[model samples]
Target: MTTYNLARYPERLAVVQLGPGSEVPSWAESSSVFSITATSTETSIICASRSVPAKTRHHRPYTAFAVVPDEGSADFDIASGVTGVLVALLTPLADAGVSVFALSTFGTDWILVHESDADRAEEAWRRSGHTVAPATPA
Candidate 1:
């Protein structure tokens, strides 16, 4: 088994909505960013940021927010974070009856949990041998 150091940074997980006629805010727009396919019904968007965007992408229709740490670092979790260590992380959450929206960059992994499950999920990861910090509000 390999050990990993996880750094929980100060960040928030928020939801954004974009309706048929709505456009996303400039600040919210980024190439690495992803949005669920647009639908007539409300779509859920999970955003991780230090502060709430001034303008939310219009009519997200549905939104789910979580306490996202600024950023969490896990070493050798994947093939240089280019692949999907996140898939492995989320698999456990799913097995434990938790749903998560996960993202990863070249350096770290971010997991967005339902606000209700934040604490539970945090503890779960810690007990599973991953270093994790308590989620903090920003």
Candidate 2:
């Protein structure tokens, strides 16, 4: 089984959607937890701090948790057609009645659990035999 170290972000986040031509807000660029996905039709931006303007369509007050391997260890390497990795992680959270908003990149996965459920989510992962640790400095 793969071991995961989870890091909880301190600030609140917002998921904002804007038209393709709209520029990303300047505040988003400097956010501690910022992610933007753009396409021809629309753009989605997840910002760690600050509120979106009233005109922007957005969901707010979400919390982010990063699931990474221990420091100095190799990444999980799930890019090579691997399976059951995410399912294993998420099943416990679901069983604990925690809903997740997940994002994946080549190296690690980020799960956004509602702020109210953060504690329960962490407890669920722990009970499932995963090691949860504070994020080490990069």
Candidate 3:
């Protein structure tokens, strides 16, 4: 098993896009924060993180994450590879002067970035041996 040092992991940022079109929503504000919790059909609670107002004229705010699954979790083996993948990706971004916010979960890691930073971050990741495809229309 590979050992990880959190401090050694590189940071990245990602933003959540709401609404449609390549253009950002004019009314979408990120300063406002709210969260939703729902009951799963399996009788479990699914809690969502609070989303802050995320839109700016030129840049959108995104949440960053470094996801690590719970100890002994069934998916830990696969999820563990994320750290190495992320670390490889982050080095170049830092060199390019990108700021990042990172978050982690039992299932996956999330990297939030300002909308302005997204394109560049993706480019850097691609150069660093990761395949980050553009987000398709939702």
Per-model TM-score, in order, reads 0.51, 0.81, 0.44
The CA lDDT at 30 in model 3 is: 32
Query: Which pairs, if any, clash in model 1?
Result: 9-70, 10-70, 11-70, 17-58, 17-59, 17-60, 18-59, 18-60
- lDDT per residue as tens, model 3, 1-138: 232212111222223433232333333333312111223321211112233243422223343323333465544356344436456546767977888755444445556655467678767665655555433222
How many angstroms is residue 20 displaced in model 3 relative to the true structure, after the best TM-score fit?
35
Write candidate 1's Cα lDDT for 67-106 as tens digits: 2323453353464453445554665567678776665544
lDDT of residue 78 for candidate 1: 62
lDDT of 1: 0.50
User: If both were scored by TM-score, which would come out higher, candidate 1 or candidate 2?
Assistant: 2
lDDT of 2 at 128: 89
Task: Pick the winner on TM-score between candidates 1 and 3.
Answer: 1
Please state the error at residue 104 of candidate 2 in Å: 1.5
Q: Write the per-residue lDDT of candidate 2 for residues 17-126, one digit (tens) a residue.
A: 88896788776644446788889999989886465676668777788888775565445575456566678789999899998888886667888877788888889989
Decoy 1 TM-score against native: 0.51
Q: Best candidate per TM-score, number?
A: 2
Instruction: Give the Cα-based TM-score of candidate 2 against the true structure.
Output: 0.81
Q: Per-model C-alpha lDDT, please?
A: 0.50, 0.76, 0.42
Query: 2 or 3, which is superior by TM-score?
Result: 2
